[model samples]
Target chain A: MAIEVNGKMIEIDEEGFLVDREDWSEDVSEAIAGRDGIELKDEHIGLIDYFRDYYEEHQVHPTMRVLVLRLGGKIGKKFHDHKEYEKFLYMLFPSDPISELCKLAGLPKPLPSEHDG
Target chain B: MAKKNDEKGTTNPELNIPLLNELEEGQWPSFVSDLKQWSKTKPQVAQLLNQLEESYENRWNYWTGTVLNVSGYGGGVIARLSEKADKYPDLAEFHTIRVIPPPGFVYSTERLRNLADICEKHGAGILQLHGLTGDALALGFDNEGTFAAAEELMANGWDLGGSGPALRSLQCCVGQARCEMACFDTMKTTRFLTNHYISFLHRPELMYKFKIKVSGCANDCANAMIGSDMPIIGTWRGPMQIDQEKVAEYIEEKGVEHVIDNVITRCPTNCLSLKGKQMVVDNENCVRCMHCINVMHKALKPGKDRGVTICLGAKRTLKIGDTMSSVIVPFMKLETEEDFQNLTDLIDRMWEFWNDNGMDHERIGEFIARVGLATFLEGCGIDPDPRMVQSTRTSPYIKFEELAPGLFEGEQTQQPKVWNREPDTREPSD
Candidate 1:
């Protein structure tokens, strides 16, 4: 399947992850997030940037705990605790923060395991 | 779907399930016989039996399906849809609902009957006394029936067990209820943990399935040491109490040779010795392997200072290899609420570290292997201890930088530094 962004057809997998990483752009991310009724905010973009960078370096997506711990250091100082930061992240994404950020970052769909309920 | 006979009347007239029939011929109790009995009343069981027979004949499993959890819960239902649904329509959507049994599996007859009624009403009337993880398995339900069964179970003050990536069912060996050697209350611990981590049990958020098992004593009746990610085994500190009179009595009853061959020789640490018909244990050298104590139960009793030993990273073979639990906390008093809170705090640290570093499909044991035990310990805020290792370090390649206090920070050593040590403070050799 595919989604149209900037009047160009961009391919996505069945779960709506980008079929090709090279096809990713800011416009494509916004278009993808739009489908999920999420408006791309600076915080969301910041998380997306972190995800893309981490994936590029480690060849694996950062888990939700890692995202909260690492990014909470920078942007989460206002929150009372790491859990509050995590709750804020949930408020932004509402659904699975890691997967949502990864999708907006235009990375491959996170591998599903029996543990991924 | 109400319970009904085969709608198509396609119950095979020439049902040739030789292998399944062979199972019924065994002397021991046979699940095949039970299924055959249930099949007389439940068509679902008949279809399941037929599917299993076909699977045995084909040498392949016919069960396949997707995750089908009840509303607002992530686990406790294992979906089982037969690939040959066209041939056996009744087995099309047979799923298993895992019900969390009471701690130590003590069930009242009334409670058990309630479970049976629910199974009969919404499932195939099939029940497993206990699954591998200690949950009562209610088998054979479709999607809608699964939700209905769960609702009934919850209404009856019962909850579903763990599935998927969540914390799997917590198991505990019968403690003070029946066992004299029970060091702590295993059932109480199980109940406490179950109530505390109820969300983790129902919510699938962990990197992989986390299992907790509590054994009343080092005998490990629950198989916690090798089967679970977190193993809480009852142990004691200080010297074990020895009764010389009972020892003499045992020696007189069992004979010298029998005692020597069976008890003395079986001491894994060679800490026991027969001194004039009385057994003497070298307390310092004893490793508490439980062999000698088990044989001379009347003579040897556990130390008064009883506590539990907590271990981590035990799991079945996956990724790295089969690994036994490694001691993290050698002994911790599990009697008071404060002690339980401490344990939960440690568990929280462990979960946080694992959730951050663990990969998909990677168990906590595998994660420890990948990240190194030191890093894991650091993440969990635990100090390195000698008890955590099997033996003294063989390799000298230690991460001294991490261990040394303020050495890299350029703090000067104290006056009694090792290199610039003071002269012997002890008086001349006497």
Candidate 2:
């Protein structure tokens, strides 16, 4: 499958995940987020950026335990305990935080077998 | 292992494997799409991938076809012609039939070969070895072909598998027939259940499907622990059989320290102890996890006085979260026909309750969650036992004597205080 952005064809896979990683841009993120009825807030963008950076470092998707520990140091404030930040995270993405972030970050859809962070 | 970015801000060519790089970018990259794209040069593989992708993408649509209902005593024969019959003319005869095998799935090699040959003659030369239940599926038969296959199967002493909202094929682990640890005949109990509920197997009278799985021992290789509605797990009540001579022989060959470190020390509940030259087991503390017996098979064996532990409410998360069954019957002797009758009666009572009260598509576990465990127990005529208590209690509350004093003096004539009343809005604002 392919998505037409500004009349330029950008390739994607069957599940609407980007086929090419380098094809990602801020415009692409906005378009993807719009599809899921999510208007990207500044914090949402920050999360997506963080996820992309983290994914670049780690080949495998991080579990919730790894996220809570790493995000505490990187983003700090109220992230000291998982319970403190969990409410806010869910508020930002009602379905799944990782799924929403990944979509906006121009990544593939997580497999049914994949565990969420 | 963070790799450095090039001056051009793109990942280095050496670091980029298209599929691996796609997977690293925060999503589950489609290997199917990758395979299709990679096999562009290979037309045959690409064509096969295209067929598979089409089947996946439009699966729900393809599943719809002529629902062939056989006028028979059994229920699980769901044979449907593929909706894609028009597009793929060769697939016009594509009909799948799910066939239930005998309990313990004991099939002779010749019988299996015969079934395969029958499938090849009528349908596509394939058998789906495993289905959602214990039944095997024969895929790719036409209307006429499927009937012929079913006739052959019946003639060969095979019957249709269970389907619809009914009892599926009862699954069981090989019991005393093969395994040394088996307490009772799992196959015998399974056959009894299957024969008695044979009519229920073919009828869609219930709200949802019910599964009954039996395991010969606590090792639970059959996975009845979390999958079945009534999970019959075998357990030993008496102390484990410990051969002193065998233990001495093992110790002499493998060393006493080795036995203690490897076998005795590994007991999860610390129920096993090595005293001088004898091994002692604290039977009360034993959880019957089958770990120790598995470790030292020569010296240790399951107790002779064996039966089954009946558990209820095991199912996948639907309305409620995924729940493992709670022990309803701690231990029950299954040797006598009367005992087996009592067990079947319990199952019937539970099913009757569920059929009456269960919502559409609601599993028994979900129904129990909505109605509460106490109600379910009462309906099933089961007395409440401490062993039936579930571990996931949200309220960790214990009432004290001091708090109980208020219960006796509950009817005090004191007027209740009220606060935060809304201001009177009867008059219009000036």
Judging by TM-score against the true structure, name the best candidate: 1
What CA RMSD would candidate 1 show? 7.5
Per-residue lDDT value at B153 in model 2: 76
Q: What is the lDDT of candidate 2?
A: 0.67
Top-lDDT candidate index: 1
Taking chain A by itself, what TM-score does each prediction score? 0.87, 0.75
Over 4 Å off, model 1: A1-112, A115-117, B1-14, B390-430
Q: What's the TM-score of candidate 2 when only chain A is evaluated? A: 0.75
Complex DockQ per candidate? 0.14, 0.01
List model 1 lDDT by residue over A46-87, tens digit each: 888888889999998887556656767565432124545565
Evaluate residue B117 in candidate 1 and report its C-alpha lDDT on the 0 to 100 scale.
99
Model 2, residue pairs in steric clash:
B74-B202, B75-B202, B76-B163
User: Tens digit of lDDT per residue, candidate 2, span B24-106?
Assistant: 45566665555445444332233234445565555544544433434343254564544544333444445667777777888
Worst 10 residues of 1 chain B by lDDT: B414-423
